[model samples]
Target chain A: GGIITQTPKFLIGQEGQKLTLKCQQNFNHDTMYWYRQDSGKGLRLIYYSITENDLQKGDLSEGYDASREKKSSFSLTVTSAQKNEMAVFLCASSRTGQDTQYFGPGTRLLVL
Target chain B: QQQVRQSPQSLTVWEGETAILNCSYEDSTFNYFPWYQQFPGEGPALLISIRSVSDKKEDGRFTIFFNKREKKLSLHITDSQPGDSATYFCAASLSNYNVLYFGSGTKLTVEP
Candidate 1:
């Protein structure tokens, strides 16, 4: 049983500040994903990578940038924090072509 | 536009009773559906799933009922326990696609 680990359980950022969230997985899965969770909004996909160095945009990818520098790691960067924005960012991974995804603990971000 | 929708934003049930959660989708092209359960301060985890071709899928106390014609599905939890309390999300995706469209989620509280 592999685990997905996310850094910085909580984050506080100022308006227009840049913040980055990191994720690491030990499942050796070929796909990694980033999702944003907001109250009453469920979860929205931001970006995903099929393999190392590969990136694909999702429905909510406009304000985020993602990187898959290694097979075991995926990272997301908030280009510019929005004021009064509070959301939880989750990282997930799965085997390519498989629908079962394992998620990390998540990082809660509050932009002041 | 949200592709997936879930009803009953929140629900409360007593132990030994049953809890039902409803979900619907707008895209008929979505052939795979998965339900994820998330506890407070944690990321979501795969609970159970059903394919479009199957009307029912069961795993222990959790069951998924699918109605392809109506583009609707429901999750039924029998013999509820306090540990079953969590937020449940309904997600849809194509069989070959890696992206998933998720519903807002239903927060279920089981009283013991």
Candidate 2:
């Protein structure tokens, strides 16, 4: 069994502030993804990496940047936080794109 | 436009009863469908999945019925339990593409 871990379970940011979220996976998977979850909205894809140093933008990557510096870790940065923006960011990993994905606990972000 | 859509934003059912969740998609290229279950404060987990080639899939008490013609699918949970209470999301993707498009989700509450 493998586990995906996300750091800083909760985050609080101010308007225009930059915030970062990190994720690590022990599954030795080849693919990693970042998604944002908002109330009453389905999970939206932010970014994904097929392997180390690879990056791809998704439907909702306008304000986010992602990195896969290492095969086991993926990180996301919020360029500028929005006022009163509250959402949960989730990280996931899969052995291959077509396989089942395992997710992390998630980081809850509250912008003031 | 949203590629995937789920009906009944929320549901309530008693123990031992069957709970059904519906999902539909707009893209004809999507050949894979997966259902995910998410608990409060946690990321979504893969519950079950089906391919467009298969009309139905069963795993323990959970079952997925797929209809290629309608571009729709449904998840049925039999003998529901309190532990089954969670938000369920339906996702669609092509076999060759790694990215998944997800529905908003259906919140299920099972009463004991």
Each model's lDDT comes to 0.96, 0.95
The C-alpha TM-scores of every prediction are: 0.98, 0.98
Where is the poorest 10-residue window by lDDT in model 1 chain A?
A93-102
lDDT (tens digit, per residue) of candidate 2 on B1-112: 9999999999999999999999999998899999999999889999999999999999999999999999999999999999999999999998747888999999999999
Give the C-alpha lDDT of model 2.
0.95
User: Candidate 1 on B19-62: residue-level lDDT in tens?
Assistant: 99999999999999999999998899999999998999999999
Best by lDDT: 1
Interface RMSD for each candidate model? 0.9, 1.5
Give each candidate's fraction of reference contacts reproduced. Answer: 0.85, 0.76
After superposing candidate 1, which stretches have Cα over 4 Å from the reference? none
State the displacement of the C-alpha of residue B85, model 1, in Å, after optimal TM-score superposition: 0.5
Q: Which ranges in model 2 have alpha carbons more than 4 Å from their true place?
A: none
Chain A (alone) TM-scores for all candidate structures? 0.98, 0.97
For candidate 2, give the lDDT of residue B68: 95
